[model samples]
Target chain A: MGVNIKNLSILIAAVALAGAWVGQGQADNEVVFPMPTGPLYVKECGSCHTAYAPGLLPARSWQKMMNELDNHFGEDASLDEPDRLAILRMLTDHAADNPNANMLMRRVAASIPRGAAPQRITETQLFRFQHDEVPAHIWKRAKIGSKANCGACHTRANEGRYPEREVRIPR
Target chain B: MMRLLALLFVMTTPAWATTPQQILDSLVQEARQTQSGFTASVSRGEQFYRAKQTGGKEADSCASCHTDNPKAEGRHIKTHKAIEALAPSANKQRFTDPAQVEKWFRRNCREVLGRVCTPQEKADFTAYVLSVK
Candidate 1:
């Protein structure tokens, strides 16, 4: 039994090393690119959530959001003419159509269903679809107050939308 | 030795990597939780399943249209195409993973459950699903 355990341990270590090597390879030529930095998307976008998953919408959608800054989620997540222009320039430069968006952005765009209709931040089908799953008692937990209070579980709301792994629903 | 057991424990937990049962419980729980901010209400998952749309060209709960697997023969009442069931693996083209699980909890909880879900309802519904097989 002792010999078997030792052999198994060695085998596990070898497999772990191999897995790490493969994981490193998967992190290939992906470049660390930045979003077009014109205004203050970090501060401005947080009104709803962070600047949204850039890939959440197409380049056209981002333009629409930026254009209608006055009515952004009923707020003004916009910048001044100079600031807005710089932001726009930055956005357009790094638009979903642009190659600079990260692989995550590009992957999200590709995953969108072919017939999916154009969706806003609030009116998205996926958003609607997901909200349907939660039960009520889960929310009444002393820790949670409201549905829109995404920050209850999603620690990253102040930073942006919930990352899948980051959400830890209250017990 | 303790670390090994801890790792094994996490790996075996259903919540970490959910199955169909866990998903269903989460749904049921969301329906039962009490929330103040909802635009609507749903006390039962079945009731939620039978809800009706408001201010639209037609009115029906999700069950009104998606009676069966959409890919088979269930067609949309409006579009006249095959209706799609909410099954994740069934519609890989739609929900790739559990991340969408939380996403829907937020979106559908409002649409059908009429609010955010409670964790208890999630557990019950998840239990209900485990019993399916």
Candidate 2:
């Protein structure tokens, strides 16, 4: 009876180890947006909000956004010529259509309509599909004002970490 | 001997950090070159800071995002991002860098006033912001 109990305990331990390994493997497969390392990009783009990962949008979307910085969304976000071109280059190099772009970026590229150009990431179908479970009322909470404020719940969002295990929705 | 020591102390003191006054002076100088009699008035600056216009699609005036008080921390009306106080007294790093100051002025003026801010307007705005102690 004692031998059977010991064997059962060993089996449970092995199963737990295998589960942990599988979990780690899954995490590795999940594509995280890479954060920009340039100082100009960090200051100019990140000052107002998270310097959104370039891979989130296709090259055409980025080009459209770059060309219209004077009326970027609702506000003027214009940059000097040299700085603008530099940022544009950086953005296009890592855009969703790039061969080196990750799985998440590829998914974003695939989800968009053939001739449609979207300005906001939240407007994308894939982004909506991923966040469909979240209640609409939760976004109005004072601590988490809008969808743009990703750092509100994604603690490591600034660092480009957005794993499901790290999300902490504020009350 | 004591006077000389005091002078030495003053000279040796690190003046590397750009001050709000220095930036304001430079803006005034730049404004003077274009407008012969340009002189920044605190009252005019304050008025500009508060005035609302029908230019922007989202934000109407500087006050819409920066709030009525420059000394107080403001929030981006749409994004809800917290903007640091604009007053030099409230935030030490307010107008330290020339590039940073120019960047905001360029974008914000277009957004709020529907045009690039003139040197005189920039000077007046700086004067008003600095006076918010």
Candidate 3:
């Protein structure tokens, strides 16, 4: 059993090393949000803005946001009880804590402090760190009116393809 | 046999979407139930749509985000997301779904008026929007 455990550890280490090597230059290239499949989620959340990817935040954040929909980010975004429950289920299922979460989700989960569930993805430390190079004025551009408008710079934001290669800072 | 298939298709197909007219009619019914002889006023609806109110963090009127012209596409002041024209004539999909209509009303009314809108108000608002064409 000791020998088997040693072998498993070595195997995991090799895989991690390989991943690091492949991800070295592509560090800036973020994993795009897989567009949510649920029609209700799309209709309800996407009606106003981009249906922000669920994997971007932990389960706690999703729960907090869903519970306080009446005061959602200064706008009343209340939902019927049944629809709210359905959307919440969808968000929590793909949340950062999911076992098969990608690099972005894993990083987000690691960075958030205990008992602090941020409603906005832009509030996350990782998001700020990733966008530190951007000047504050850039977010105020006519085309890129706000930092929340990911599609303004991320060409395929709606399709969840936010690769750095595709980014085009709109004037 | 062909007639039976057509009948089956009509029976099985669900009308998930309720038209703007249907929504307006339903609102009228609701308004009349509470207030006898209550007729939707397009002018009053227009006033309600453009009226500015306090208590909200950002834009006060439905017109603030929707723009003064319901025929024109509006922008979310904070998020910068493009809102399609509210006029049914300009945007065919506007007010097509019952759930969509209710959801926005529940949110927007609370934001603009700081409370839930009455059925009469909803009817008037719908009538005003529908009249824009």
What is the C-alpha local distance difference test score of each model? 0.50, 0.83, 0.84
Which structure among the candidates has the greatest TM-score?
Answer: 3
Can you write out model 2's per-residue Cα lDDT over A65-165, one digit (the tens) per residue? 99999777777898889999999988888787878777777888898887977889889897788789989899999878888877778777767677787
lDDT value for model 3:
0.84
Q: Give candidate 1's error at residue A102 in angstroms.
A: 4.1
lDDT of 2 by residue, B10-72 (tens): 788654467888999999999999998888999999988898877655778889888999988
DockQ of each: 0.01, 0.47, 0.60
lDDT of 3 by residue, A96-145 (tens): 87786777678779999978998888989988988999998998898888
Candidate 2 vs candidate 3, DockQ winner: 3
All models, RMSD in angstroms? 19.9, 8.3, 6.9
Best to worst by DockQ, what's the order?
3, 2, 1
Off by over 4 Å in 2: A1-31, B1-17, B34-37
Cα lDDT tens digits for candidate 1, B3-42: 9999999778744365554455444445456543322222
C-alpha lDDT (0 to 100) for residue A130 of candidate 1: 55
Q: How many clashes (backbone N, Cα, C below 3 Å) per candidate?
A: 44, 0, 0
